[model samples]
Target: MTITPETLIAAAQSSKAWPFQEAQRLAKRMPKGKPGGVLFETGYGPSGLPHIGTFQEVLRTTLVRRAYEALTGGAPTRLVAFSDDMDGLRKVPDNVPNRDMLAQHLGKPLSRIPDPFEKFESFAAHNNAMLRDFLDRFGFEYEFVSSSECYNGGKFDTALKGVLSNFQAILDIMLPTLGEERRQTYSPVMPVSPTTGAVLQVPIEVVDAEAGLIRFTDEDGAIVEQSALGGMAKCQWKVDWAMRWVALGVDYEMYGKDLTDSGIQSGKIARVLGGHKPEGLIYELFLDGEGEKISKSKGNGLSIEDWLQYGSEESLGYYIFANPRSAKQLHGGVIPKAVDDYWQFRAALPGQELDKQLGNPVWHLLRANESHAGANAPGSGDTLPVPFSLLLNLVGVLGVGATREAVWSYLGNYVTNADPAAHPALDALVDKALAYNRDFVAPTLAKRAPSGGEVGALQALDAALADADPAISAEDLQTIVYEIGKQPEFGFDNLRNWFKALYETLLGSEQGPRMGSFIALYGIAPTRALIAEALAKA
Candidate 1:
């Protein structure tokens, strides 16, 4: 289908997806034909190693930028991945080594501290490299900004001077938000200790705005005075946030919900420094397997690399596409569904309305035009004949890391006229299913004896299969499982439970493809023999 500008723009403006809608909203809010084009920023703090949560900020920003460009006839857009490496190391994370070594150097700028991993110049460099590596692996189009270089090189000089000049005004913006205790010690520009090279959070007793200088008592109680512009001192998080916008003119940005308070304060500070705040959005945090909020410093979630090992990059993109405002899980268990959901979305696209087709997540995942839809949509056009769950069951039968030839061989043995080699989606499904089994679905599974109720269900299934022809459709097999679940003597009151019994007893897992479909593919004789073995154990 030809991608007319009208369909694409309408879909972007009216979509339920947050990124698409946000891009439309923010684009309209941009100055009527501004000279600077569009700039989107994703900020990261180098306090700990980059995690899965870090990807959301950049990915979400990229999505919105893409939407904006698509809607505006491919307008120029640039994404800046900014790292706040100049920030101080408040505490050492438990994930890395040399905690004691880092703890001793707490309160120092991140760039001033030695690398606990000893692979980079400093702790900040080590963490920043990790963030870059992740972005590179995904082939993201973005520019990297180092706060340390920007500050130390005088790139932030103008903003810093403006902040110092309007010190009192910015303080009034921040002081009202702080507690009595915090207000007393707060200074917008925190000074790095001259003696220890530590970032001092102590109150600034004097500010010579005219001379671009500030004085504060060091941790040792000695008075230290320094120039604020040449990286002698750095703005606190809130001030730094505003300073970045003023210097770079970031058009859009986002942060976690927990930082809303600081965000508001920083916006006020930015206005005081003669700059408007970036268009800001809030996203809900990701939780761990146990449902606790994922934290970079706490190390409470899966690493980005870990997730990628068991799932495709497209799966991760689906997770990001989910409710942007609701707390969600980032575990391996979500990976399989993410993969399946993308397939489902693509499978429904071809016959959809122009606007609907344009808004499909598959298009955004491909990051391409509607005419280029062929690039990412899985399967032949929109007819997705196989279920991903069924392919997962194949993973179990064939085992992990099975070759393409082996998978095709297995398919040929069961399903008539099957050509797994020609199926574009088969190989990926097998890989994901095995990874899901190993990383999320395998550990909780164990050998178990079938219950009496399920024994009847299995016997019923066996009798039905005994009379069945060698060839069967997935739909036919599904109907057989449902009919068996309805028999009174079986006591398989719920059809769902009956399916669970089949998966657990026969497949040794809690979930599987439709029973009829699985049985048909595995061949009626082999399926019946497996059920017989399960019944013998019972």
Candidate 2:
């Protein structure tokens, strides 16, 4: 499909990808001809190390920027991953090394606290370096901004003045959300103590809008006068959000759904600060399997390192692309399916309509780099005929930590023409599958005990294999399994259950690639022997 300008424009206009619609809304809401292209912001909190959930937002924001550029005749777009490091260290992250040290720094800004690992200038710097390292590794296009720098560098001096001038109005906007006690003392600006260098949450004794200064009681109850400018003081979160939007002239920004109310308040405060709010995109947060929000404190869901260990960077990108507005489970268990779906999209990309291709998440996943994180690297051979889940199980057939060449040799048993060396992309899957098996599958296999029905089903399958053609293809073998499940005694409701039966008793996993594909690759005789052995104990 040759994607023409007209077709691209129409597709961009109707694109269901959140970024495309966001670009259109931003283009209308924020007129062009500004000093820079459309500016977008992805907020980060440095209280904890970055994770997969945080990484997805940056990648997703980049997609929007790309879409915006295409829609506006290559309009410029800048994605700023702004970290709110100036916010106080409310609590120590459960994962970091130095808990006792961090406990001593509570109420101190993240940028001011000591690095737990003693590597960077501060805890925030360490986290920031970690974020940049992986982002650069993935070749993501973004600029990093620290809230501490913006505050102390006097970069937001003008924004500070504007907020202070409208202090009463912002107070009126915020007071309704606070308790009566907080309503009386809470100010838009959160004063930083010059004496102890902590963010003072105490009552403000004075505010001088003309001078951009606030005097408040410090943590020890001593008077501390601080300038709101030059990073001596930072505005409270919602107010700080509004100030940044105006200071940077952010055209677009996205937030988690939990921030909906705070976002609206930021918009109101933006108006009070004599500026308009950025066009906003609210995404549902990634959740653990238990349907609870994934956070550093909770220690649930896969970390960015964990996800990348068992899957490709593009696989995680595709996971982010799938129904982003809807909350999704981001656990180790979801990795293989994401990898398989990426292949499905790539396999289907060819012969697809231009608009249809545009709508596919695989399309975006492929172009992980500039001009693309294309699912198939240029000249990289096609995806393996087998799915990733299936590949993992087949790789597992070779036992733990089997080298790629060994797995390729195993594939040669059933496929006379099998050559993984020709397919770098598919071969990489073999490596990841080995990692997935060693880490996620091997341990679970120790406790897999088939139920009575599943045992009978396996026994039945073994008996059917006894009479099956020794030279049957994977596709034909798949049909035999389907027929076995359809028999009255098995009474399997669907192929899904039938497949699950095989996975539980055979692979010792909840999901596996199609049995036919495995059968075709494993060869008829070896597969039957494996099944017979598994059913022996039944």
Per-candidate Cα lDDT values, in order, are 0.77, 0.78
lDDT of 1 by residue, 181-296 (tens): 99989998888888888887888844677677888898899887778877788998889999899899888998899999888888888888888878867988889899998766
lDDT, candidate 1, at 16: 67
Instruction: Report the poorest 10 consecutive residues by lDDT, candidate 1.
Output: 368-377
**Per-residue lDDT of model 2, residues 1-538, tens digit only:** 4566777877877877666777788767654525677788898888877777677888887777777776766777788889899999998777889899999999899999999999999999999898788678878888999998998788998989888888778888999999988877787887878777788766563468778877777777777776777878888989999999999988888878899999999999998888888876788998898888887666788888888789987788888887668999888889988988887777777757767776777666555358453443332443555678777888777678578888887677554467765666667778888999888787777325556666777777777777877776777878878887787676677878878878776777776777878877766677777777676756
lDDT of 2 at 517: 80
Off by over 4 Å in 1: 31-33, 98-104, 205-210, 219-222, 296-299, 368-386, 395-409, 413-425, 446-457, 483-501, 508-511
